[model samples]
Target: MEPHLVTDERLRRVLDDLIRREPLFHRPEFGTTRADFAAMTASDFWETGASEQRYDRAYVLDALEERHQDPPVEEWETSEFSCRELAADVYLLTYTLVLDGRMSRRATIWQQDPDGWKVVYHQGTVVQGS
Candidate 1:
């Protein structure tokens, strides 16, 4: 069965807001500092990479800090965004990301706090035969 790509009308605004920040940590306007990254993610944030390896918040933050010092030139595209409310002030967002002609499906769980949206968890799975 084909997956649902269109977000519900009720979630349109939230979807739009989240989409802009997706493929997370890639937008410079959101900030590139370690502290910025820390603020964007929850204290226990973790992610499963496309490689299927699990990484914790501290490791990920350290890696991001290193990458920021000498960022790589990346050309990518994102599409097929969908969002669902998982609970009060929490949402699950899913989308596809294409980088260097390879595609991966990404999901991020976000929580809205007074500070702003903070990612609780994230995962990426490479699209087979892509």
Candidate 2:
């Protein structure tokens, strides 16, 4: 596969890991090493919260962990798992995260290079705050 697609695929897998409630998702420092997301930080709550009235990946994760455990991987929150390429090197990943049965959205931005992909930016929003 093209390096970009492979990078994107690996990045997508990280997203899936989180949505699927992979216990490792708690590590805020993971995912950065992936060939495709070397520039990204494990999802953050502060950054995410700032994007929309105060919500971040960490915040949501904490909230979710506080209430739910091993949420259904298929039904946890992100009802979907896909991204749209906005540019040759830019892509946006959209998905839902459920914490305490409340659903929120997390958006991650990625940039691509000839060697792999990297998460250049990210943000999250508490759409329902369940």
Best by lDDT: 1
Count the clashes in each prediction: 0, 10
For candidate 1, the TM-score is: 0.95
Query: Which stretches of candidate 1 lie above 4 Å from their native place?
Result: 128-130
Q: Give lDDT tens digits, candidate 1, residues 89-115.
A: 899999889987789989999999999
Residues 26-74, model 2: lDDT tens digits? 3334431232122333333134452355545455445545434443434
lDDT of 2 at 1: 62
